[model samples]
Target: MSEYRSLEDKLNYQFNDEQLLGLALTHRSFSNVNNERLEFLGDSILNYVISLAIFQRFDSASEGELSRMRSSLVRKETLAEIGRELDIGELIKFGIGERKSGGINRSSILADAVESIFGGILVDGGFLNASSVITRVFNKRLEKLSSDDFMKDPKSLLQEKLQDMGEPPPDYIIISTKGKSPHEVFEVACISRVLKKEARAEGASKRKAEQKAARIALTEMDRDR
Candidate 1:
């Protein structure tokens, strides 16, 4: 009967306290009693679950490799991707201003909401249930992860490529930022002066924006080569 019944179905878990689910989907822009705390708790829970899963799945992986893979898996981009898959953006409760500014599709908001849902599940059901849900949701991603690709992020790879070509590293500059705290959107430009190339991108955070910009720059560089 709850409007969130569909989300519960996607998560494959029902909450005894429907309020918890509501809170998980509530953004700070919507209310003071939002999902930040839940996001923090869920971040930790997600890391643990993913770390354990990867550790077991890739038994031959070194510690450094495992760390890199975990970082890739737990990054905001990955979380945002998962959130999109679950259509979480549509369910998020945002403030009028945020909603008007397209907060629903914002990566940071989506990622935070996904984590908060995990936290809510932990609080409502227990670690077992929380882990079960996490594992189930991430099962395909875990299976599809490749050791060769997970070692380095886009930024790192771009930097290394530039270095190999005897070019200086790209500089990430914040072009502009919009919105208020916890819901801000940042536009960044990754400029490679030596290569005479530049790429611009927007994200919910500076680092994410820079990463995206770097990825674009990398793609352009590769295409030109």
Candidate 2:
């Protein structure tokens, strides 16, 4: 009971099927019957929920603006941030191999678990129940939405900045990755072929790592300018 209480308080959603909640917190690295299906279902539901909410909330916004806003909210980093607030990482059940390799702290696992929990809610209750949970979870973010919330993703922004300087596109190289599948950390190097600049960063996914490295490169370029 104590084990579940903290998460319940954080999410503000009590589980009718505690088993489903358990499944949600179980990573694929732990078991064959794992959170993957739930993650898939939850991903779709989250997109729909966020899209509809943003669409109705921003009546004057164009399609492009809406899409950008949605991307910002649903990105892996954002989801992992929210999952951290819930302390979901500590609760994730990983296999011995995954545990020894530091899979529990992996942002990708935490983010996917968050989505799986949403899917569990949908299964235990219904769409409206899950929608209520999503609304509650996202209330503050939705309230603070604005034109300022939208921006090109880090990778895109970095690429554009280099191109504007008459430089060749940055070359991204994966330095290494750690932990198990679906829960690995990607270390990437962002190298500017023309400027001979290099920056390295790590993230839960390859794309995220690349973006982080690119962001670092961009910051250095800006500071130099």
Candidate 3:
């Protein structure tokens, strides 16, 4: 019924409840009409699934520890990775202007689509089916992120660094977010804790944006040493 038909075939999964898939493919910008509800359900479902996964995966983890891990899992950047894997980016529907700007590949959009897909599957198939599919999609990410390298995403790492320095911590300012909800322009800056200076970069999410800024700041800080 739509371009997403190709994507459905690609993911090696089909929905008897085709409407759910349709809802997932629809973008909020296309109209206020469809996607918002799915996104909402998807968001909650994702949180529940991820929390369960974290709780079981790390039994010794503290509440705060589990929370940080959950945040790492559910962030826009993480969901975008799942969306990209399904090639959902190419199949998404967008408004005309948003389409022209390449919104489909955006981290935020891809992330939202991941939620929509989760919500859709839950509606059509139930939590078990939705969770199975989502788990399949997230398995590799889960494994990789569990590694030491993912100890902190760029944002958290920067915050920790600032906190260690006894500073107020860096805050993000979005300079530009173009394209569509998915593949848009996202130029972000990190405001200094003390100097009030700012460093900036373009990335798909706030984490990425902040990472770039932090990298710059770290380099500058080292230089002064």
Candidate 4:
């Protein structure tokens, strides 16, 4: 035994199928092994678990309200935040190159690893058991999410701020689009109203590109203030 006690202590999941835990911790960059399938399953599992939590947590909330709340909980940022709380990044086994390149600190990578591990737990135990574990991990978060006023869309907020500043509304310009078919990268720039400062970002989708650009704008504005 390599003394896998650290993660078990962290997650409170004593794995009967310890290999599943190992598989979950293994990143694809490590080899031909794929965490993709587990990620897919885990994504669905997490949604269901979170959905139930939302439904029960908010009796007066409507379906749409619950959906929005659930969406907030399951976002990449939220998942990454939870992953950080678990210190899951420290436990992830990455390829030598990836480890050196700071892959463990990447939010997206950490989020995927957490989801894969959650799926592995589901496979090792029944759905109810898995749900129990997931719920426990997320209970505090669910309560916090329920209490907080949901954040407005960043892009929309950015636009509103620009308008209030008496500047022309923000505009997005597509600078470049590249990469293979399924993973095309989009680089976009957000043109600020008064400052004329252009901030750019790259993402896999147009919406993501827009959001990234907005985030850049927000950052630039804060520095000047």
Best by lDDT: 1
Q: Of the candidates numbered 3 and 4, which has the greater lDDT value?
A: 4
Q: What is candidate 2's TM-score against the reference?
A: 0.68
User: Could you tell me the lDDT of residue 24 within candidate 4?
Assistant: 82
State which candidate has the highest TM-score.
Answer: 1
Q: Write the per-residue lDDT of candidate 1 for residues 1-225, one digit (tens) a residue.
A: 899999899999999999999999999999999999999889989999998999988888756567667766888889999999999898999999999999999998899999999999999999999999999999998999888874467799788878977888888999999999999999999998644567999999999998888777766664443
lDDT of 3 by residue, 81-150 (tens): 8788778877677888888888987889898988988888888888888788767766776766553432
Q: All candidates' lDDT scores?
A: 0.88, 0.82, 0.74, 0.79
| Tens-place lDDT digits, model 4, residues 1-225 | 555677777777788888787788788999677677778878889999998888887887744446557766787888898888888887788999999999999999988978888898889886877788788888887767753353356587678767866777788999999998799999998887654578899999888999888866765664353
Q: Please report, as a residue range, the 10-residue window in candidate 3 with the lowest summed lDDT.
A: 145-154
TM-score of each model, in listed order: 0.69, 0.68, 0.64, 0.65
Write down the lDDT that model 1 would get. Answer: 0.88
User: Which residue segments of model 4 deviate by more than 4 Å?
Assistant: 151-225
Off by over 4 Å in 1: 151-225
Question: Number of clashes in every candidate structure?
Answer: 0, 0, 7, 0
| Candidate 4 backbone collisions, by pair | none
User: What is the full ranking by TM-score, best candidate first?
Assistant: 1, 2, 4, 3
Off by over 4 Å in 3: 1-6, 9-12, 147-158, 161-225
